[model samples]
Target: MNTQIQRNYEAAKQIYANLGIDTEKAIVKLKDIKISMHCWQGDDVRGFLNKDQDLTGGISVTGNYPGAARTPEELRQDLEKAYSLIPGKHKLNLHAIYADTDEKIDLDEIEPRHYEKWVQWAKKQGLGLDFNPTCFSHPKSDDGFTLSHPNKEIRDFWIEHCKRARKVGEYFGKETGQPCVTNVWIPDGFKDQPVDRLGPRERLQASLDEVFKEEINPAYNLDAIESKLFGIGSESYVVGSHEFYMGYGLTRNKLICLDAGHFHPTEVVSNKLSALSLFSEGMLLHVSRPVRWDSDHVVTMDDETLAIARELVVHNLISKTHIGLDFFDASINRVAAWVIGTRNMLKALLRAMLEPTESLKEAELRGDYTTRLALMEELKSYPFGAVWDYYCESSNVPVREDWLKEVKDYETNVLLKRD
Candidate 1:
């Protein structure tokens, strides 16, 4: 530990002490919160199916940056490097397509054994694993639909795939001793206006029912459904709109996934957390920075992200929320992208934890709006960076801007060497 960092942290602690907040307790609490980091960013959403498939599902990864992981081993290596720099024990979010086998395993035929390597890896790292059913980037999803496809055969294929994915998720949960959140997100929409939207939604609901027919123990696995407003090719209409999934999640007792970029440009996902937590069993958050559209850019310490952390802390919904990152930016260093996004997320959570919640609530309850606003504004200038630096130091990860040197060294010695 650097002496300078400890000195700064102690000073910051005293400042927080004056506000009736314990900085030490905040750091300890932050350590317990684990953010699920997505695996797709390392490979630009290109899984090791070896089928020469193009990305579908109204999703696309722009920029042909060098050194994208071409194999499961490389991806895991990059993830390990990234995780070593991030504080706290975290979870890895995997898609069904990231199976570590060389065999031509069809999506419908995938089994838990296919992901045994990932289970073993997570076990070694003492990390939990979450899962997703890849309903896109395959021949079956060429029509910009899967679960809601007009063809029963295609829909059945997707249903079977989701069933297998749930089983895999259960296996992960059992192995890691944490509930695996199995999320379902499909790109079932139309580029042009669809006259029969209700038909597709009905089919989708039926498909979901069939997929989730088998009951898995809540201890092992939980189900979640994600909705998207618009995508690259599905700008005209999205079948699985927010209203559709919100209703389904409430009625079916499933976790509703709220992607930061899945709603309108003006819609704040942070604002919806409390409202949804009131009815839904739980919720999955896909944290990403969207540039105008649903472009999965790396997250930063932006207002929206900070607001999300604030909501989770203020509402005490951290336990009920399954936090996960969902972004794929191939333009920069892939490992650096993971470190930046994950660190920013942790920082936001830390900032929220260091808030003077008790005082703020007391002021609010007493109808002291002026003091509430003043305290809120004053908190913006707190020595959050000092606390964050202390956190990185105590967690044994690189502190502040110092972590960049390690990334640069890795890029030179490892990434740049890749053809």
Candidate 2:
């Protein structure tokens, strides 16, 4: 144990204890919480199915940094390196196209066996896995539509793909002993305003109904639907709007995925969490940073992220919320992106847990707004970093920016060689 970390943690622990907060308990809670790390970050969203194809749909990866993983093996290698740098155990969020098998299969033809390698690797790593169906980047979706594509054949193709994705999710949950969240997101909308928006939305609802027709055991797999306000090709109109999924999720008894970057610039997904929690059974959050639109920038310890973590802790929604990262920055080290984003999320959660919420709630309930405001402002100067450092040190991961050296070393020895 580092003497300085121990000293700092002790001093900080006293400060939090004075506020009736338990720093040790916060670390214990943070350790148990898992943030499902997105797999697309390592390879700039280019899965193994067709590496050469241009990214379709509205999303785009801007950077061309050297040594993006070109195969499933390389991606997993990068993920392993990333997991080593971040503290605590977490799960991997896998996209369908990253299927580990060498089979000649398209999106609709995918099966659970295609992801057997990933499940085995996850078991060996003592990690769990979540899944997503690839609704974008396919020829059928080139026209910027998937489940709601006016063409019946195109619609059926995506539906079948989603159906199988659930099975894959089920397989992962059964094997890893942690339920997997199989989320669906589609870029089905038009570039310009269409004469009738209702038809597309109705078709999308029907398609989703058909996709969720098969019931999987809730103990093994959970279904979630993600809604995007607008996307690249569908900037003028997005079929899967937030309201659309909110209604569908409520009626269908599915988890609604509120993506940070998927909403309008003025709309914070954190603000919606508490409201939705009242009615929804559970939610899957896509923690991200958006500059103006859905840029998918690497996450930081920003205000919105803090609010999100605080909301979950204050509302006691941690048990019902599924946290996942959904960002990619090809301009920098990909593995480092994973470590930075994920570490910040965990830190946010820890900070939330360290808050003297019971005292704050009592103040708010008594209409002591001034006290509540003053205490929150005073807490901003608390020794959070010291406890975070001790947590990382105890977990055997590098503290603060010390992890950067490891990433840089991996880049020189591993990533650069791939180029």
Candidate 3:
């Protein structure tokens, strides 16, 4: 093994030891699927397809290359290149609304170009594209939507933009075989005092309704609409923040997406499960770990907090969902960053697979918060390294007695056997 591989193995072994896990059996519980920077290894993504050691069926791409293309042809070429890099099983995470340029461009001009390129690209490649659209300010949202300013011009401009994007989405679904994704990770609410942007919630809700009604169709749907509670940098967030919670509560569309790191750490808020509770709603799940519960997206499998989050995914609390390996690294080599990230994510997934099934379902329906929390605590105590020692000790992994009884009690008394 290379130095890094050796180092990782040793580190994992040490973690297992510290957690009182048996090194041999612990390795058996590890297996998962992933795609990452290595998915685009060496910029020759096609080269690594079905060849790289990591898991398969997961890869995402920004629209074409890095810089904005001036024409439809340039966009088409970028799409083609992105397609070439994608595997047959993977979907392309297209950046429909770029942070800088997308906010500025006229929807009328940009939508046609996007539509033409997406249609042609699908024809040539036989694959559908997923969208990542932004909904926030630049020069246009200066006064805010219906929420902040209620200015006719700003809201009208956004209305036009949403209409154009929805048209493009409809065209994409009709021509290509992919569903339209309404990615509204908007930073609309403020962190501090808001002198000018009061009653922002009304504007936001009105805008959402208008956009949905005008742009979206009964059949033309959203695969996953993201709902971020907060944001970093100059961008603000809706949903989780105090100013936005009421608005977020009111705006309940199906198939909402939640970032794992978005919630306050060590809390069982079940942001993923909460999204599912919305009548007939589904979710697109984004998994990333926060350092100190901030946006330090260095997700690792070894993190216990992440393991708890993993329990949610494996138990199928939220189904019909797509996954995003959400990570941003400015300091490391891009390839290395993805490799490390992919590895960590896969490990978490594998551990989740080992999670006990029916009991989890039971916990969900019981409405007993205490029982559910205890069950999660038990699930977390699976004896990462030493099964024997784990059993001998006060660990959660059932050994001598029927551990199923404990699981049953929690399910029956607490959750009332919903499973």
Please give the lDDT score for candidate 1: 0.93
Taking the tens digit of each residue's C-alpha lDDT, what string does model 2 give over 62-132?
88888899888899999999999999999999999999877888989998899999998999999999999
Which segments of candidate 3 are over 4 A away from where they belong? 1-88, 98-108, 115-128, 142-148, 195-198, 215-220, 223-225, 232-252, 266-275, 278-280, 292-298, 302-309, 312-314, 339-347, 356-419
TM-score of model 2 vs. true structure? 0.99
> What value of lDDT does candidate 2 attain over all alpha carbons?
0.93
* Tens-place lDDT digits, model 1, residues 1-419: 89999999999999999988899989988999989999999999988874389988888888887888988888888999999999999999999999988677899999989999999999999899999999999999988999999899889999999999999999999999999999999999989898998999999999999999999999999999999998878999998999999999999999999999999998989999999999999999999998876888999999999999999999899999999999999999999999999999999999999899988999999999999999999999999899999999988999987888998998888888888
- Rank the candidate models, highest lDDT first: 1, 2, 3
TM-score of each: 0.99, 0.99, 0.57
lDDT of each: 0.93, 0.93, 0.45
Worst 10 residues of 1 by lDDT: 48-57
Q: For residues 1-419, what per-residue lDDT tens digits would candidate 3 score against the true structure?
A: 23543454456556655545445453333312212221222222222111222211112222232233333344344434433322222334444443123234443234645446445655676655455443342445433222234576766666666656666666666666556554544545454455654466667656656666653562544634454444543234342243253234335554565566666566433433544545435555556656645353545765543654464555454244555556544333333334345445544554554454445667677777677777668657653323232322222223323433543443345323222
- The 10-residue segment of model 2 with minimum total lDDT is 50-59
Model 3 residue 34 CA deviation in Å: 9.3
- Of candidate 3, the 10-residue stretch with the lowest lDDT total is 48-57
